[model samples]
Target: MKNKIIGVCPNCGANVVEREKGWFCENRECRFVLWKDNAFFKRLGKRLDYHVADKLLRDGRVRLKDCKSAKGKTYNATVLLSCEADGRSKFSLEFEGGC
Candidate 1:
């Protein structure tokens, strides 16, 4: 089966397609990608699933309702998506009331 088109590449304006291991920009020169088993999300006790990935690509942010802290406390936050100079994805969290 052919890969599904997920969104536009934030770096190169190419089509972002879903692959087995990750979502990737179709432009050969673009390094933009979102790995399914991303270490960043893993650290937050979350998997980078399709819904979150789609929202991040389309809106550059997604609200995570139950993020577990290292100490096992659950909290809600908005995850912001940004691109690095090399087209790699970078993420940060925004918490309510300066958490």
Candidate 2:
């Protein structure tokens, strides 16, 4: 099997590598945890379950919202996956109103 390095993690900002065991973050302290589970998903009206979230995380695909960095900057991010050491998740968003 062949693995590809996709660069650093977006959540923790640590290096991410594709290995035989699948993609794993280089940061030992980091779990590379993706989006929130049941409560969060329900609150956000996401049509996914806990099990699905886990699968998506493993597949490097999860969404994040209302994210604030360590620098105190807040952003409305639509991440396609949780591929960061900073603990950010990936998602696609829909804008209902004018910007």
Candidate 3:
């Protein structure tokens, strides 16, 4: 496969690469990781797929197609990506009326 430009890392601002398991910061100094088995998505009944990772890294946010809410109902929402001062990345969801 050809080299693909995944997106910029939120922590160190380096380029992120897509591997078999997840997206990783190219810079060793950064040590940022976004695992595919992230619990955030698993609880929502979804997988942390490549497309979502790409969007989050590229734009700092991604619109999920469908996700189960706390009520066991499916809904659409935007996921916001942010990095902590300690170089850890996290994800949060925004609903229509703002969760």
TM per candidate comes to: 0.95, 0.34, 0.85
Deviation in Å, model 3, residue 11 alpha carbon: 1.6
Candidate 2 residues lying further than 4 Å off, grouped into runs, are 1-4, 33-79, 82-99
lDDT of 2 at 6: 49
**In candidate 2, what are the lDDT values of residues 67-88, reduced to their tens digit?**
5545656545443443343444
Q: What is every candidate's alpha-carbon RMSD to the true fold?
A: 1.2, 10.3, 2.1
- Could you give candidate 1's per-residue lDDT for residues 5-62 as a string of tens digits? 9999998899999999999999999899999999888878899999989999999999
Q: What is candidate 3's lDDT per residue for 17-64, written digit by digit as tens?
A: 878777888888786778999999887888888888887887888888
RMSD of 2: 10.3
Question: What does the lDDT read for residue 69 in candidate 3?
Answer: 74
If the candidates were sorted by their TM-score against the true structure, best first, what order would they fall in? 1, 3, 2
Report residue 64 deviation for candidate 1 (angstroms).
Answer: 0.2
**Best first by lDDT, ranked:** 1, 3, 2
Give me the candidate number with maximum lDDT.
Answer: 1
In terms of TM-score, which candidate is strongest? Answer: 1
Estimate every model's Cα lDDT from 0 to 1: 0.92, 0.50, 0.82
